[model samples]
Target: MIRPRRPERKAPPLLPPLKLYKAILRTHVHKLPIELRSLGDEYVKAEFKAHQNIDNPLHIVGFLTQWQDYLKNLDGGSWQEGKLSQEDLDKMSPEQVNQLYELMLETKRLGSEG
Candidate 1:
């Protein structure tokens, strides 16, 4: 006998990239500290620009999902307490790991300067 099919769960629709980018910059980034606001804005601009030509649905979904989570964290005032889980770090490619390291160093440098 065949097993019954489970109902498919639908994810909430994501905002379009341009709209989400504007929300992050206009609504969220300005709430950050001066140093962090500049850094976050630059990073967000670069990330969005880099992904502008991406055509893969999964990649787009994943990118938007992570950014949406970031927006939520900022809105909730818990963004400063966020940390990368080891499991999430393990999934990064070598280039991504290096990029993360560079960002960390830059953050530290800014922190020391402030």
Candidate 2:
């Protein structure tokens, strides 16, 4: 017997990179606290700059997808309550994990200094 074919799921539309970057910086980042706004802006700028030359479609999609989720969370006022899921942590490379750890430490230090 032949198996029935299932329809492929479609991903929601994403903003183009420059548009998304501007949206994050111009709209979302302004809603953050002063210190956090500075940090968030710098981080977003650096990440976008770093990925500007990336040629892989999958990597670009994943990068944009994550940033888009962040934008959505900020818009919905749940960004502070966000936590990394185990599945997401499992997907990170060692370097990415280290970077996340460092960012955590920096945020903690900023919190302490405030």
Candidate 3:
């Protein structure tokens, strides 16, 4: 008996690795206006400064949510968004550097876990 052959099916691409995801999240946070990005991050840093053990993952997710809202609001404001160029990283304030580090660490942890 002759049987019909089926076409090969390929799986969808896997989501980006966690390192990339965290970097995106950190970048998103850094690019937000100080007013928009400050509250949650200040909370995280304050807790850290107090020597409290904070949930780093939750902090990252919370920041991600805030960043998304900022993106939504800046939906058409490219001019403001333009200021956060690659050049800006070198000039980032100490707090921004810390946030970036925290985000990258969380992302690396997520990537390793998966």
Candidate 4:
């Protein structure tokens, strides 16, 4: 008997609900988890991609322009602007937390040195 191999699954696209995406960018974190965070991320990506295509035009041009501006300023450490909450860190086990924090700090140090 021949066995068949299973196909690999692709990561789902990030296309967020319009209102929820705006809310997240607005820093309404408490309400975010009440809905679906993963779904929100998916929707954002999908919308961004859709607007990026030649077929359908959208306001994404402004967003892409801002991203380009940010990239141009990437010589400094502006890439890492946001902070992760202590509550979020505390939820992880000590080993995982230490590893993640160590890697994050190392990345920041390297970015700052350059």
Candidate 4 residues lying further than 4 Å off, grouped into runs, are 1-79
* TM-score (C-alpha, index-matched) for candidate 3: 0.29
User: Model 1 reaches what TM-score against the true structure?
Assistant: 0.86
Tens-digit lDDT string for candidate 2 (1-114): 998999989877999999999889876546787767787888899899999999999999999999988888887789889999999899999989998998899888888888
lDDT ranking from best to worst? 1, 2, 3, 4
- In the range 1-112, model 3's lDDT, one tens digit per residue, is 9989998897433333343334434654756554445444554445335533445867555544544444444444562534345786887788888977786676466556
- Candidate 4 lDDT over 21-54, as tens digits, reads 4544444233344244344355445655665554
* lDDT of all predictions: 0.89, 0.87, 0.53, 0.49
TM-score of each: 0.86, 0.86, 0.29, 0.28
Residues 13-86, candidate 1: write the lDDT tens digits: 78889988998998544578888888889999999999999999999999999898888788788888899999
Please give the clash total of every predicted structure, in order. 0, 0, 0, 8
CA RMSD for every model?
A: 3.6, 3.4, 17.0, 16.3
Weakest 10 consecutive residues of candidate 2 by summed lDDT: 27-36
Segments in model 3 whose C-alpha atoms lie over 4 Å from true places? 1-85
Top candidate (lDDT)? 1
For model 2, the local distance difference test gives 0.87
Per-residue lDDT value at 72 in model 3: 46
